[model samples]
Target: MLGLIKKDLLIIKNNIKFAIIFIVVFVCFTEQSSELLYFVPIFLSTMLFISTFSYDDYNKWDAYACTLPQGKKSVVKAKYLASLLLTLMAVLITLILGFIIGAINKNFDAKEMLEIISGVVVAIVLLQSIMFPLMYKYGVEKGRIGIFLGVFGMSGLIGFLFKYLNIKIPNNVIQTFNDYWFIILPIIVILMILVSYNISKKIYLKKEF
Candidate 1:
């Protein structure tokens, strides 16, 4: 399992230049934007990590991986683990970049940063929970389309809430969730990931490749 995880990491490492460019672009946007978009990097990392499935498919890695000792389950597990690692890295990077930007602009807010972090963690977990199983069932190309549609749908919903309904979410609600998140979020995320893993594993197990 560790070796499988390492393999995915190596693949990402080979694409370090692109990742660096992405980070720079995201950092620049976050630094300039007023909205709490600090979570974007984490979400982007999750997407990029997930896109690795397409790369594996392109290279025929999936068919080859089936003959390996670890089998499809390990392959699926490694992708999930790799995503988790990338999310953690994104969190750390966001923290550092947020602090630097705050220090420069004299607008540091620890509570807001924490809220963003917690929100990003839950969002990525939930998004990936839905996405991984779909990818396993439908293949990466369709999975990528699904992800884009999901994002667009989410964005539209938020827009409708804010624009048409003139409804703004209360900060207190966010605060309350963040207060209990240490206990609540972990349980929810873990259960979701476990369910997603089972689904993906079942799909991969029955796949011809």
Candidate 2:
């Protein structure tokens, strides 16, 4: 499993230069307080991790991996672990960059930074949790299209509903979320990842290659 994880990390390391350039560009251009400061790097990093599936498919890694003990299971485990590690690294990098940007802007709000980080991290994790199973089942290229359509459709639906239906959240519910989110969100993310991992493992176990 460690070797499998290393393989994915090495693949990502080769592309780290481009990821850094993206991070720098987003951080420099966006406001210090903008949520993009926290989101762009993490999204880019996770997408890089997802690209490993493309490499694996092209190289026929899965067929070769099946010869090893627990190979299929390890492959899925390694991917989720590697992705989590990448997500963590992105969050830390953004935290450092956020502080620097705040310093330069002469206004740093720790609570606001925490809020943005928390929201962005949860959103990315949820997105990945939804994506991994699809990537495993459909392969990377199709999975990318699925994600695009899913996000686009959901966004459109949400906008239409909000504009036409005038749906609004109660302030108390929003406040509750804001207050307990730091505690509740992690628990929800953990559950989602666990479920996503289980589904991906099942798919890979039954997969042809």
Which candidate number has the best lDDT?
2
Whole-model Cα lDDT of every candidate shown, in order: 0.82, 0.86
| Predicted candidate 1 versus true structure: per-residue lDDT over 79-115, tens digit per residue | 8888888888888978887888888888888888887
Model 2 residue runs over 4 Å out of place are 28-35
Predicted candidate 2 versus true structure: per-residue lDDT over 1-209, tens digit per residue? 99888999999999899988877777667764555676777788887988888998899999999998878779899989999988898889888887888888888777888888878888888889888899888988898899888888988999999899999989999999888987789999899999999999999999996
**Model 2: colliding residue pairs:** none
- TM-scores, each model vs. reference: 0.81, 0.91
Give the residue spans of candidate 1 off by over 4 A: 26-37, 149-179
Deviation from native of the Cα of residue 88 in model 1, angstroms = 1.0
